[model samples]
Target: MNPPQNPPQDPPQDAQLQADTVWLESIRRRIRSPSQRNPDMSWENNAADLIERQLQYDGHRTWGFVIYRTTYASDADWAEFLRRLRFQMEDMFDYFNGRDILEKFALTVFEDRSLFDGASTDTIRQHFQQWSSTAYRTEQQQQQLEEGSGSGGSAGRVSIGRSPRYRFAVQVDAEALHSVVHDAPAPPELDTTKKGWVKLIDKSWYLGRSEGKSDPLEPIKGVAEEDVGWMKVPYQNVMTEYYTKCRSPNNWSLNYRRPPKVAGSPFD
Candidate 1:
């Protein structure tokens, strides 16, 4: 008699697919209210989907950032914006494997030029500096205390660790913003003229070092403008560059630092 054959089993789910499922579900839950959703919501979701697909097929993991233009009429509006952003970030961290991955991401906000009628970019940057310093100091103190407790050392004697490495968000002048979108060489498919909540992916640009030398931008970047948004960048390259930058003595900076040179052909 012939032995009975076992039934075929389903293939294991791809890790990238599993991560994408979690990410999409988190986004859906957060965007429950119409008032809470923004025009770029679809683009952001598309970007995430594209990133996951690339990871599945090509073993690449691309990161993205959004350029938001806003005009705040009152302090209350600004406060509300900050509250929403904080909650969104918290949700992203929870959904995307926590701070280790998210620490590299950031949102760039450029206020409508009209709002700068009486203010200079320097003034705005200075204000942000003061705010960041106070907020980071408080957070750092708490982190030190927690670490000290875990290590069985006195909180007062805890060694000062490296300053928080990444900025979750930043405000920049029109000139600086132009440098990112227009000045950098982008793929021919990308349209730099587009505005209002633009999400760019896999661009080569970096923050200036403490010595005041900005890392020059490289070419063959990808953009997620309008409806079409897809790109593939190597995962190993991203992490290698991140760790390399983390080793720098003057690693802490106020501006948004770009990821390392992307490997492989442009838009591959």
Candidate 2:
């Protein structure tokens, strides 16, 4: 019977189905591939990650950090960050791994915002000492074994400076805090019209104070509007540029920073 009537050949597989969760149908692109994204640029250990782990936020209006001052902007506005405190103390801390990847020092938790605030520039060194103290007990045990000629490896020492006073949560999650910052700046929660309230949402923006000079409207000492590294900038424009990174930088000189969720979160 002519090998039975041959069925029509099936068409090629859909490009969509070939890729699993790896493919984003909406954007039609790979979610994230190592080659496409730099691993060093990620949360892995490097200068950025090291600096980030050592970071502590206090909501205080301090230099080089996002600080919120004033509980009220206008008579009608009685507003301030709720500043919810959270704690996440990991049982173990590990960075990315590779035989070639080695760091002389490791970041350690000294005391979550329970004890210090990173308000001082010397905060880094302070926390380093705190970490050293905590790691002392662990070091002693290893030292004992090594003294007896046992090959027990020595734990790398950790140190930190006084942390900027972040909200007091005894054990804090560095990852969660990082996420909270990243997830912040959404619409309606922040509105730029409020006075005396500027948000330094990005960490990089507050490194320079002088570029294109002018006194920031509320050049509150230690609380610059933004950092214009290695240049003199109008201090007034710092707050303006901060919001612009999120929504409207062109609307410069708005004289206020809005909540990231301001589109509907009360500020709208």
TM-scores vs. true structure, each candidate: 0.29, 0.24
Model 2 lDDT, residue 180, Cα: 32
Q: How well is each residue in 112-133 modelled by candidate 1, as lDDT tens digits? A: 5565433432344444444444
- Candidate 2 accuracy as TM-score: 0.24
RMSD of 2: 14.1
Worst 10 residues of 2 by lDDT: 84-93
Best candidate, lDDT? 1
Candidate 1 residue-wise lDDT at 68:
29
Which ranges of candidate 2 are over 4 A from the true structure?
A: 1-151, 155-212, 221-225, 228-268
> Candidate 2 — what's its lDDT?
0.28
Residue pairs with clashing backbones, model 1 = none
Which ranges of candidate 1 are over 4 A from the true structure? 1-72, 97-119, 124-139, 142-153, 156-169, 172-268
| Candidate with maximal TM-score | 1
